[model samples]
Target: MDLQRQIRNGWFFFLKHIFNPLTRRIARTSFGPFAIVRHVGRRSGKQYETPIIVSPAKDGFVIELTYGPDVDWHKNVLAANGCTVVWHGKEFAVDKPEPLDTETGRAAFPPPQQLVLNLLGRKHFEKLTCKKDE
Candidate 1:
């Protein structure tokens, strides 16, 4: 494999209790009180799972993705349509991994990425290959 791909493959397979913990602080909200997820690399098919922030939606939950595109879980979320999630120590079926253009996520995210979210609205990220789909 190419050096970059080899390095990334080795690196991504192992996340820690520090980075991909069961719970982590997100903007001081202790957001795991809200959401979490379990997914894998889309192209590599390596297994991975982690906690994240989420909001209730219809019969499922909507995740405000922070890691941005090019990450495994984000790509996995899109591929699986509804990735497995655990919230507040409980598991739930998460559907529609939407990128919401909330005041916070929009402004905090990169300008180019924010524009895509603004244009796509919500629930479309699940179907996108990347932000370019918008």
Candidate 2:
């Protein structure tokens, strides 16, 4: 396998087995860029909570698609048409998850984060709009 693909697979294994579990322990309460995304599996109907980095937007939030748009959590949110996000110790009902272009996605993050993401070759992002009170 190519170095990039190997690295990607290794990273995925690490994230799934190590990082995600550790992150979940503190993700919901930690006052950092991380947040917990609550979504239900489309096929199994099982509930899942994933740790993710989120940047606040005008009326919602921006999420970097580090593992690309095909990741289970992203696919679940898309299939369900919405998901709840636990950010800064508060639960937010967000919907309308739409893909964003690289430039537009990068613009949502701070310069430092944008630079890091660019360096990591992350180009996909999704914008989740906050559900409005009726």
Candidate 3:
């Protein structure tokens, strides 16, 4: 495998096996802007909910790709074409998972978040739009 792919996989392993468990526990509450994405496994047909930090955009929300686009949940969302997101004490049917360039993605959020994204090397993002009445 390529070196970049290997590094990404290693980071994913740590997040999946370590960070995710702790984040999952804290994501259930309204402590912050944390959201939960409910999606099904592409190959396994298993349901999974993942915690994510999101900021509202004009027509949807911008999901920070902290771990890049290789993560399982991001792939699952793409494969499924849609998913349910629990955010800000409500559930939203989010669709249209599109990866935006760094400039476009950073423009979706406010100044503080944009600065943080830049600092974190988060150039990948998913633009999800809510489906009405879902």
Q: All models: lDDT?
A: 0.53, 0.89, 0.83
lDDT of 2: 0.89
Instruction: Report how far residue 73 has shifted in candidate 1, in Å.
Output: 0.8
For model 1, residues 10-125, the per-residue Cα lDDT tens digits are 76555453455434444224343345566777777777665554544445554555455566667687787756666555556555455544664445445665576578663222
Off by over 4 Å in 2: 1-11
Q: How far is 43's C-alpha from truth in model 3 (Å)?
A: 1.2
Best by lDDT: 2
CA RMSD for every model? Answer: 9.5, 2.6, 3.6
**Tens-digit lDDT track of model 2 for 1-134:** 99999999999899899999877767677566788899999999999999987899999999987778888888899899999998888899999588899999998999889899899988998898999998
Model 2, residue 33: distance off in Å is: 1.5
Q: Residue 65 in candidate 2 has what lDDT?
A: 78
- Candidate 1, backbone clash total: 0
TM-score winner among the candidates? Answer: 2
Runs with alpha carbons beyond 4 Å of true place in candidate 3: 1-14
Error of 3 at 96 (Å): 2.9
lDDT of 1 at 127: 20
